[model samples]
Target chain A: MAPSIVVRDVLDREAVRRSVDTALADFLAAKARTATSQPQLGYLSGLLQDFMAGGKRIRPLLCATGWYAVGGGEDPRSVFQVAACLEMFHAFALIHDDVMDNSDTRRGRPTVHRTLAEHSAGRRGEEELERFAHSAAVLLGDLALTWSDELLHEAGLTPVQLGAVLPLLNEMRTELMVGQFLDLDATGGLTDDIEATLNVNRYKTAKYTIERPLHIGAAIAGAGAEAMAAFTAFALPLGEAFQLRDDLLGIYGDPGTTGKSRLDDLRAGKNTTLTALALRGADAAQTARLRSSLGNPLLDERGAADVREIFEATGARATVERMIDERHRQALAALEDSPFPFAPDALAALEEIAHLATVRNS
Target chain B: MAPSIVVRDVLDREAVRRSVDTALADFLAAKARTATSQPQLGYLSGLLQDFMAGGKRIRPLLCATGWYAVGGGEDPRSVFQVAACLEMFHAFALIHDDVMDNSDTRRGRPTVHRTLAEHSAGRRGEEELERFAHSAAVLLGDLALTWSDELLHEAGLTPVQLGAVLPLLNEMRTELMVGQFLDLDATGGLTDDIEATLNVNRYKTAKYTIERPLHIGAAIAGAGAEAMAAFTAFALPLGEAFQLRDDLLGIYGDPGTTGKSRLDDLRAGKNTTLTALALRGADAAQTARLRSSLGNPLLDERGAADVREIFEATGARATVERMIDERHRQALAALEDSPFPFAPDALAALEEIAHLATVRNS
Candidate 1:
C-alpha cells in the first residue's frame, strides 16, 4: 500500500473543485461530440453545462474530504470522477426541485423550466407553453440523473468498491425522494409538529446532503464499520445544523449575500422547523394570520416581514439558533470520539466545516 | 465451461414472467420492510406493485429471449433480476409519460397521478390537490428509477458484464428522453413530415423498447459482435412495426379491446406517421378541418369519426398498414440472414413476436 497522504493537502478545496469541474466539462463535451448525429442533443448538453457552472460544489467537497479523511487509499482520479457524479446528481435534484416548487429563479438566474419556456416562445399559447416547459424540464432532469450514473460507472471503481457504494447511493436517492414527498404532503397546511419537521430535515439534508456522500467516499476507500459509524456520528448533527441554517438563510439573509429571495420559502408555505415552532407557540390570532398569509401565492415582502416578526415574537428564531449551536458542538465532539486515529488536518477540516455550516450567513 | 442450457426451455414465456414477477415482488417487499420507520413508504411500495401487475412484460420477455437466444451462459436467476429491472424502469417511464399527457386511465385503471389525486382528496381544494398529485407522481417516478438502479446492482453480474451493460442502459434512457423531447416539441402542431415522424419512432420504439433490452441481455451472456448485430437488425424493424400497430390501435381499435381511449392521440394532436401521411395527402378543405378539429381540447367521438374518415379517404390508414407489413417482413428477413448459427426455437420465437407485433389489434 502507498503511504497515507496528509488529509488537508489531499482535500485542498480549490483543487478538488477545479478537478471535479474539469471532469464534468470534459464528460459533457464528449457527450456533445457523440451527439453530432443528432445536433439537437448538443443543445441539451450546453444547457446542462451552463446550469452546472454556478453551484457551490458542497457535496463534492464533502465527498473529497471524506475520502481524504479515510487516508486517500484509492487513485484520486476515480475519486474525482465520483465527486463529479455527485455534482451532476445535485444538478438533477435542483432542476426537478425548482419545477416542483414552481420556482422562477435559482442561483440568481432563470430556472431551467423558465429558460425552456423562453426557448419555446412563439410556439404555443400560454397554457401549452407552460406545460411544455415543465415537462421538458422534467425530461432534462431525468437525463442528468442518467448521465450521473454514467459518470459513476466511468469512474472506474473496482467491483468490490462499486458493490459497496451502490447500496448507499441508492439509499441516499430513495431517502431524498421520501423527504420530498413528505415535504409536499405537509405544504399548504400549517403544522406545529416540530418532531415531524425534524424528521423531514434529517431525511432530506442530514443523510442525503452529508452522511451518504461521506459514506460513499469512505466506502470507495474500503473503510470499515468503525470508521463508517464514526462518520455517521459526525455527519448527522452537522448536517442538521446545515439545514437549520439554510432555513434561517431562506428567511432572514440578505438577497445580495445569499443570491436567493428570502420570501420564496414563505410564499411557498415551506413547513420548516422554525415555522413549526412558531406555530406551536403562537396565540390564536397569530396562528390565524399565519394560516391565511403563509401559503398565499401572492405573498409579498410585507407578508414575509410579518411572518418573521411572529417567528421572533414566539422565540422560534432564537430557539433555532440555539439548536444550531448545540448540533455544531455535538458534531465537533463526534470527531474527538472517533475510533480511528484521524489525521490532525482531517479533524481540523471537519471542525472548520462545522463552524461554517452553523455560523455563516450563507 | 459448463454446457449451455437449451434455449427454448430457458425462455419459456410463462416461466420467465413468473420468475421476473417474483423478483420484483420480493424486491419491493424488502423495500417495504426497510421503510418501517415511515409507514407511508409502504403505501408507495404497494402502489408500485399494483401498477406493475398488469403490463404485458414485453420488454422483460424480449430481454429473456435475447439472453436465451445467446445460449444462456449465465445463471438464469441473474438474468431474471435484470429483466425485472427493465420492467421497473418501464414503470418509471410510463408513470412520468402519463403525468405529461395528463391521461386518466391506463391498463383499465386510473393512472398513478389519478390514484394519488384521489388519495389526497379531502385534504385540499381542487387545484392544490391536482398540483400535489402531479408533483408526487413525478417523485414516485424518481423513486421507481432509483429502485431500478438498485435492482440492477443486486443482479450480481460480474464486473465485465456490468461494464458492458451500463453504457447500453444509459444510452437507452437518453434515447427515450430525446424521443420524448421531440414528441413534446411536435405535439399541438400538425405536420406532414413523414421522415420526422419515423425518426421519433426509431428512437422511441426501435431503440428504447427493443434494441437496448436485447443488447443488455446479450451482453450479460458475453455474446459476440455478430450476435449483437443480428439482434439489432432483427429488433429495429420489429419494434417499428410494434409502434405502428400501436398507432393504429390508438385510432381505430375498440376501447374494450385496447384498454385505451381511441380518441386520445387525436385529442392531443400527436403527430404520428398516420397523421403525417394523412396531412401529406389531404386536400385543402380536408387539411383545414384537421388543423381546426385536432388538438381541440373538447374533441369528442364525432370529431374523431371525421378524423378517421379523412384517414381512410386520404389512404393514410392503408399506407400505415402497408408500412407495418413491410417492416415486419424486413424484420423476419434479417433474422433469416443472421451470421451465427441461431437456435431453431429462438428463430421461431422471433417470428412469433413479429407476427404478434404487426397483426395485433391491441
Candidate 2:
C-alpha cells in the first residue's frame, strides 16, 4: 500500500488541473443536454456556472492521494470523476451552509444567498431579503446536490466501485446534514461538554472534508481493510487539527487577505477553542460581561473589539494556539505510527498542508 | 421492446412491495453501523415505519416497468433495487413537501414536523418548536436520501444501468426543486398564465411523480430506445393527468376519502385547475378577491367556501375532468404505437392504471 512520489513541484499542476477541468467541462455539457429530450428543465443546467468557480482542486488532490495510498498505480485521469464528486459535494455544503450561517461572502464573491438576497432587495422591500435568501439558497443547494450525483455517476467507477462509493458518499451527505443539526443544536443548547462540540465538527466538517473522500478514493482503488484502518487512524487526528486551525483563522486572520472578517467569530460568538478558553479563564465579573455582550445580533465593530480584548486578557488565544500545536503533533505522530505508504514527496506535501492550514496568514 | 400486460400488473403490486421492504430493511440495518450512525434515527425510523402502509406502491412498480421497457428481462428480483430507489426517493419528497406546505397530517398521522413541533411546544419555547420541526424534517429527508442510494447500489443492474438511472433521477430532483421555485415564484407573481402555472406541475410534479419512475423501471427492465420513447410518450400525458386529478381532488373531493380538506386549496388560493378556471370564468370582483386572498395565510372556512363556490360556478371541476379523460386516452393510445413486449396481461394492467388515475371512484 505504498504511495509513490509522483509530482514534486507545482509545475505538474496541469495534471491536477486537467483532472478537475475535464470533469467540470464534461459535467456542464452532459447536464446541459439532459431533460432536453423532454424539454422540461429549460436551461436549468446553467445554475452550475457561478456555483463552481475558482476551486483550487484541493479535494481532488486529496482524492488522488487516497487512491495512491492503496498501492494503486497512478491513473491521474481515472481519479478526476471521483475528484469532481468531492469538489461538487464541497460546493453543495457551501450553498446550504451560507444560508444557515447567514454568510455574505464565499471565496472572494457574495455567497449564493447573499447575492440572491441583494438581487431580491433591488426589486423589492427590505423584508424580502431573508425570505429571498432562504428560498434561493434552498434551490441552489438542490442544484449543487443533484450535480454531485451526476458527477459521481460520470466518474466511470465500476459496479463494485459504485457499490463502494455511492453508499459511502450518500452516508457522508447524511452525516453532514446531521452534523450541521448537531452543531445548531449545540449552539442553541449547551453544556461544559467541549467534546460534544468537537464531535459536531468531526461529523459536520472533518469526515466529509477529509475522511470519506479519502475512503471513497481508497475504496475505489481497492484498498484492503488493513490499509483503510491505517488511513483512518492517520486521517482522524489530522482532520481534527485541520478544523481547529480553521476556527482559529476565523477569529484572528487578516480579514482582507482571508476574504472573511476577523471579527466574525467574535460577533457571532462562536464557542470555539479560544472562546472556551476565555470562558474558562474569565473571573466572575469578566464572565458576566462576556456572556452579556456575546452573540449580539446587533454587534458593532466597537463591540467586536471589546470581545477581542476579553479573548486576549483571558489567555484564550494562547490556549487555543497550544491546543492546535498539540493536535498537529498528534497528527504527525499518528502518521508515523500507522503503516501508511509515505513517499518522501507526499510526506513533504502533507507537512506543507499542515503549515498552510495552521500557520499561513490566510 | 414489447411490454406484457402480466408483467406490468405483477410489477405494479407484489414485486414493488417486495422491493420496498427488502431495500428499506436491508438499507437501514447496514446504514446504522456507519460512523454517522443514529440511534434516534431508529426511533425516527418509525416515521417511515408505515411509509409502505398506505402507498399504492405505484412508483416502485413503475420503476420495474421502466427497467423492463429498456430491454430488461422478467427477472423481477433484479429490478428490486431500482424499485426500492424509486420508493425511497418518493418518500423523501413527501416528507419534505409536508414541511414546505405545512401539512398537518399525512396518511392520517401528524406530519413528521408537526409531530415534533407539537411535542416540543409545551416542553420548550416556540423557538424550540420551530427548530425541532425544521431539524426533524431535514433529518428525515436525509434518511430517505441515503436509503435511496443504498437501494440503487443493490439494484443488481449493471453499472451502465445504474448510470442511466442516476442522470434521470438527478434531473427529476432538479425539476422538483425548480418546480418548488416556480411555485414560490408564483406565490404573488403572475397567476393569470394558467399554462405557465401548469408547466410547473408538469415539470416539477408530473414528470417525477409518474413519468420518471416509469421510465426508470422500463430502463432497468432493458427496454430499448423505441420502448423508452413510447414510455415517455405515454407517461407524460398519464403523469400529467395523475397530478391534475389530484389537484382537482384537493378542491372538490371528500376529505374523508382523500385524508385532506376539499376546501384547503381554495382557502390557500392555490393556482390549480379550479383556481385557474375561477380566474378565467369569474367576473372582475371575484378575480380581484381571488388575487387579494391567494396565499393570504389567514383565509378560514367561510372564505374557503366562497372560493369553492366560485370554482363550481365557473365549472373548473368539469373542465379538468374532461382534460383528465383526454390525457388518459392519450396515454393509452401511446402504448399502441410502441413495440413494447407488454404482453396482453401487462398491457391490461398498465391500462388499468390509466383507469385508476382518472376514475372518480376506486
Candidate 3:
C-alpha cells in the first residue's frame, strides 16, 4: 500500500483552494450552458459564483487535509470535487441564513436578497419588491442545494466510496438544520444557560464546521475507527474554540476586517456563550441592563459599550477568553495523543490550522 | 425474467397510499426518537406528520404506477419507500411555497408559518414573532428536504437502481426551482405572454409533478430510453392539463371543497395561463379593471366578481377550459399510442389518474 500520509498537494492549502475553485467554476459553467432555455438560471448562477468567490475556503482546505491525514488514494481529483460540493452547500446555508437574519450585507457586500431587491428597484411597491426579492433568494438557495447534490453525484466515487459518504453527509445536513432551528428559536430571548449555548455551538459549528468535514474526508480515505475517533477528539474542542473566537469577533472585531457589523449579534439578542456567561454572573442591576439593551432593535454603539462594560465587570469576557484558551490547548493535546499515525507534515498542518481557527479575529 | 407488468398491489391506489404513509410515519418516528436532545425536532416532526396526513398522495401513486408500468420486480416495498420520499419532498416544497406566498392557510389549516407564529403568540412582539415563525418554518422546510434525501438513501435500492434515479431527481428539483423563480418574477404584474405562462406550467407542474415522478419510478425498475420517452409523452400534456384545471379551480372553485381561499391567487397576482389569456383578449377598460383589481391586497368578493366578469367577457375562462380538454385528450392519445407494452391494469391506472388529474375540483 502507498504510505498512509497525505501527499504534498493535499497539504498545500493554496493548491487545494485553487483546485476546488476550479471544480466549482467548471460545474457552474456547465449548468449555465445547459440552461439555455432559462436565462434566469444563468443570472442566479452568476450571483452564486460571485457569492462563492469571497469565502475563506476553510472547509475545503480541512476536507482535503482530512483526506490526506488518513492516507487517501493518490489521485486528489475526486477529493477536490467533493470539497467543491461542501463549498456549494455552505453557500446554500449562508444565503438562507442571510434571509433569516434579514442581514443587509455579507463578506462586505450586499446579501443575496438585498442584491435581488436592488435588481428589482422601481418595478413594484417597496413591500412587494421586498417580498419578491426574499422569495427569489429562497429559490436561489434551493437551487444551490440541489446543485451541491449534483456535484457529489457527478464526482465519480465508486459505489463503496459513495455508500460510506452518503450517511455522513446526511447526518451533517440534518445536524446543521437542527442547529439552525435551535438558534432561531433561542434568538430574541436572553438566556443564562451556558450549557444550552454550547450545545448550539457544538451542533452548528463544531460538528458541522469542523468534525463532519474531517470525518467525511477520512471516510473517503477508508480510514479505520481509530482515525475517525481521533479526528472527533481533536475536532470538537477545536471547533468550539473556533466558534468561541467567532462570538468574540462578532462583538469586538472591526467591521472592515470581519466584513459585518459587530452589533448584529447584540441587536439580535443571540444567546451566545459569552452573553450567557455574562448573564450568569451579573448582579440584578447588570442583569436588568443586559436584558433591556441586548435585544433592542435600536441599540446604538453607546448601548453596546454599556453592554461591554457589564461583560467586563462581571468577568464574562475574561472567562470566555480562558475557555477559548483551554479548548485550544485541549485540541492540540488530542492531536498529540491520537493513536492514528500521521505524517510529520500532516501533524504540523493540523497544528497550524488549530492556531488559525482559535486565534484569528475573523 | 418476470413479465413486465405491475401486479395487483401496484395497481391499487389506496394500498399504495397506505404503504407510503406507513413508510413516512415510520421514518419520521425514527427521526423524532433519535433527536432526544432536541425536543424541537420532535415538535417539527409532529407538525410534518400532521401536514403529510392531508396530502392526496398523488406523487406516490404515480410513482407506484410508473414502477409497475415498466414491469418492476415482485416486491413493491422499495417502490413504496421511494414514493414516500417523493411525498416528503412535496411537503418540503409546499412549506416553503407557503412562506414565499405568505399564505395564511393550506388544506383548511393554518400554514406552517402561521401555525408556528400562533405557537409563539405571547413570547414576542408581533413583528418579531412573525420573523421567528418565518425563520423557523424555513428551517423546518430545510429539515424536510434533508430527511427526504435520507429516505431515498435508506430505501433498499441496489446501487444500479440508485444510479438510475439520482440524475432524474436532481433534474426534477432544479426544474422545479427554475419554474418557481419564473413564477415569482412574473407575479404582481399582468402579462399577455401566454407562451411564457405555459412554459412555467411545463416546468413547475408538468415536468416536476408528473414527468419526473414517473421517470424516477421507471428508472428504478431499470427502464430503457424508449419506455422513459413514452412516460414523458404521456405525462407532459396530462401535467399541463392538471395545472390548467388548477388555475380555473383557484379562481372559481368553492372554498368548502378546495379548502383554500379562491382570492389567494388573484391577490398575489399570479400570472397563470388563464390570466395571460384574459390579458390577451381584454379591451382597454377591461384590461385596466383586471390589472387594478387582480393584485389588490384588499380585494374582496365584490372585486373578485368584477375580475370574474372580465374573465368571462374576454372568454378567458372558456379558452382555459378548452385548453384543458385538448391537453387531456392529447395525454390520453399518447398513452394509447405508446409502445412500452404496459400491462392492461397499469394502463388502466394511468388512464384513471389522467382523468382524475384534469377533472378534479381540489
How does each model score on TM-score? 0.97, 0.89, 0.97
lDDT of 3 by residue, A1-362 (tens): 12332457787878887788888999899889877898878888998998898888888888888988988788877787888999999999999999998888888889999999999999888999999988888888888888988899988888888888898899899889889888988898889999999999999999999898888888788878999899899999999999999999888989898888978888888899999999999999999999999988789999999999998999999999999999999999999999999878889989988999998877
Q: Under CAPRI classification, how is model 1 graded?
A: medium
In model 2, what is the error at residue B211, expressed in angstroms?
1.8
- C-alpha lDDT of all candidate models, in order: 0.87, 0.66, 0.89
- Candidate 1 DockQ score? 0.77
The CAPRI quality class of candidate 3 comes to high
TM-score of 2: 0.89
The residue ranges of model 3 lying beyond 4 angstroms of the native Cα positions read: A1-6, B1-6
The best candidate by lDDT is 3
Model 1 over residues B99-123: C-alpha lDDT tens digits? 9898888887899999999998999
Cα displacement (Å) at residue B281, model 1: 1.0
Comparing 1 and 2 on DockQ, the stronger one:
1
Q: Quote the positional error of residue A72 for candidate 2 in Å.
A: 4.5
**CAPRI band for model 2:** acceptable
Candidate 2 structure quality by residue, lDDT tens digits, A157-269: 76667667666677677777767766655453323355765777777766767777677777887777776776666566667767777777787677776767765555555
Kindly give the stretch of ten consecutive residues in candidate 1 chain B with the minimal lDDT sum. B1-10
